[model samples]
Target: MNGPDILASLRANLAQQVQHYISPIPAPLDVSPWLAMALLQKAIRRGHHPFALQAAATLLQLSPDKLWRRAVSIAFEDIGIADLEIVSLVTASLAGKAFRAKIGGEWLVASYLVERMCLAPKCRSADDLLMLSERHPAYEHLRLGLTYGTIPELLALVRSNAPLPKRALALWYAVGSDRCPSPQLRTRKGAPQTVFDDLCEAGHPHTLVEVAREGFRRSGQVLCPFVVLLASQKSEQPAFIEDDDFPPETMCGSLPSWALDVYSREGQQALRRFLGRNCDTARWVRSHVPPVQRIKFLGDILFAVEGGLLRNHYRWPLADELRRSWAIECQGPFCPDAGEIMSMLRIDIQLLNEERQHV
Candidate 1:
């Protein structure tokens, strides 16, 4: 065939190939090696340029593996930062599909040309450069000398400089707001159980503050133990003096003003009415107050006392006298039906004693 006829035939074949292979979403650019090679071969047959034909041939000669690697690179470099989801989806899809092995030599070259033409070039700025450096310090030296002018240049730089894991991390951070500082920190293996021990031991304000700051740094979330410890430290109230000899009503009245705020109005009224009606009639009180109700009330009172004692280990001076009267009236051998109430009160006493040991 004559040179002009061969050139015309090559152009017609390339146009057919383009229609068959390339998807028509983004406008196809001249960056495609397959397209460039076809055009270059046609021009060379027409005696146009030897250097251009050699360049296209060299690009066409790239192995499938190298071309697929370039495609993966373009996925991240071109689609990353601006629309990082595309990078993730493309990378995952490529990995899952095993595109390099599936496409084979010539087809792989054609696929690269199509992909390169279809996707937009991504650009990275000084901010992205700094962030990349922070994310992967290993690449700091390589990134130092390069100055990127376009999206394609930035993508090329990333492909050359960043490792697969670093590329994945950068893509993850770019795609989602829930980026973790390090994978180890996010995983269970990186967290230490001793941090919880420290929080539990954080009895004072200073220690709790330190635990909170350290916990936040170690894990993105706050540790519950430190929060509890801090709350306990901050809510500590002043000690109240208890009068053992005073009536239950009088003792309740003598409670600190701040202590009154702890209970709801209804609870305060119920407690006050119970104390007022039962202060002198111990026998009647035991009969009216059911064993279960007495036990529940005692449990609540014991919890309050333990919390109060932790804040300030003050003796309720009235506690001994009240206990003496309660023991006599509720546990006395002469009192009939005292057995059940006494049994419930004894259980409360045991719980109270246990709480004291912990304090």
Candidate 2:
């Protein structure tokens, strides 16, 4: 089926599922839409259905647009190859507030998706590869060349037997950097439609391709198509779905500890207070990182440890490599002492969390 037909069929087939889906989850009365988004993704990643549903409800009330956008992104970014059907369901949910109202109402549809995603198998390889393609020093020359390659040439390269990440770079360039802008990459106009059609021609699965197309159309992220490309070659391989280690969890006032991550205003203040203390974590950051980059540096480590903690770890050749790259290159080089620093932070973070709750 073509893109529209595929979505249409999904909408028809999943209508009953959404209509009957029910959750008693209540929106946290005080969560800011920003924290709600942060909580939603992490909750989904951790397979915490209650928190995911609550955050989804809160975000739906506060910012339905961002809620839907976040849903589509996690579908590609976290749940990519593990469950393409769920990805497609989330993609179909992007049909706007009205369609949702008809099929199951906004909250029902949103809650249904959050619950399913929490239970679905997880794979973050697509977003991991996208990050590597852009940031890893090895791709510096490849990035420059692909950024300027002609649409036809880039399209051909996408189908070539090049390395996976390199081919992803070519596919992104073909999709047009202008459409999927990255401050890190030189931007050019891309033929996103042609790129999607070409993937179909290249024998990639239709559901994945269509989800990628609609996902990119909605999110404007290159990770969408990368999910299709990454899954195309690995779907048949021996795959493992194991329970990942749980990230340390603590409560900060009314919200989960993660909601106070460096991005949140509260999280920043807590980190500031945490850093101000006469502690080894503070001393290490002070000596190793510049004064200006300390909070961000620490935040990156915090993310490595706590954020994006996938509860359902999907293992395949490419997915495993991406996980290793994430450990070694993605976060390893930037913060070599991440483990040591995290141990230090754990000791005093509670002190800051307690203080923030009072504030």
Candidate 3:
């Protein structure tokens, strides 16, 4: 038959083959559900495949439905853009009533759940981004047209021989911010590449472009790179510690005047919406979302941002500690105190946003 049908047949055959091994399921734990789930997450993060499976099995003994839902949440929040397709795989596996009801459908699903969790690539960038986005003081200023109104003037100045780094951030901001009315990004290999990618390829750092693509793929949201650039400009300390961490700001010395002309033509409403989300809606979306699908959007964003900050800021100092604790390369960058970095980035962006308002 077709590919999916064949795959289904294979899964069915494999499930049957393992049927004898599925009995004597683990006893339901007397532990708190949150605690049990946390323990399972810890195992998964540590790449302890056996322990992760055992935890999933334990949770399944209590409630298959809960296990299934939690698995999806982890796929989004933990795995995230590091492997965006994992969420789709999780959904396809747990999509229907029949699939959920399948070993006559119980424990096989647990096997599927654990296998998926263990195999998925983990990244916490989205989580960190969400957390930072929440408390960023600039959110209010940006929403009120304080930051939105400056685009034309800023674009004009960048085109008029302002530093290359400034030009690059300006061009990237227009394209990456979703404020562009009719964005026509270039494509490479049929996937959309950012307008600033050419500048990136020419030796300028493209962290913003990479961030925008990864964040969008994972959460369907466009990150405002301009916010980051503005934040960096205001901070006396460099946005990145290492010069090579991202492309040098001066890589593109002068942007074409026409590059950002398109944004000037868009109506105020679209810009307002984007600004509102940055300033207002985003603040509560994370904490207020229902548990089942919260990680899908809000959670993914927070984890990814958190992961990014930890990687950029604390990765070196904690390397030895991380090596001891985590077997995977991905684990080296995690920091429990990532909120501090987020606050720093947010405050810089906020200060710049505030400055723009007063000027």
Candidate 3 Cα misplacement greater than 4 A, ranges:
1-27, 102-104, 143-359
1-359: candidate 3 lDDT, tens digit per residue: 43345335544654454455453355444544544565466455545456566667767776666676666556554554444344444544454557546644666656655665566555543333333322233232322232242445434543445533334334434343443221222211111243334424433234433433333343333222322232233333322222112111111111111111112222122222223344433344333444344323322332222212211121222222322222211211233233343343233333222322221
- TM-score of candidate 2 to 2 decimals: 0.92
Whole-model lDDT, candidate 2?
Answer: 0.80
TM-score of 3: 0.37
Error of 2 at 84 (Å): 0.7
Error of 2 at 21 (Å): 2.2
- In model 3, how large is the Cα lDDT of residue 54? 68
Q: Tens digits of per-residue lDDT for model 2 on 144-226?
A: 87776888899888888998888888998888888888766897898899999988988888877887888898889888989
Ranking by lDDT: 2, 3, 1
Q: Predictions ranked by TM-score, top down?
A: 2, 3, 1
Against the true structure, what is each candidate's TM-score? Answer: 0.21, 0.92, 0.37
Worst lDDT 10-window in candidate 2: 330-339
Q: What would the per-residue lDDT of candidate 1 be over residues 28-52, giving only the tens digit for each residue? A: 2223354333333222212223322
The CA lDDT of each predicted structure is: 0.31, 0.80, 0.39
Highest-TM-score candidate: 2
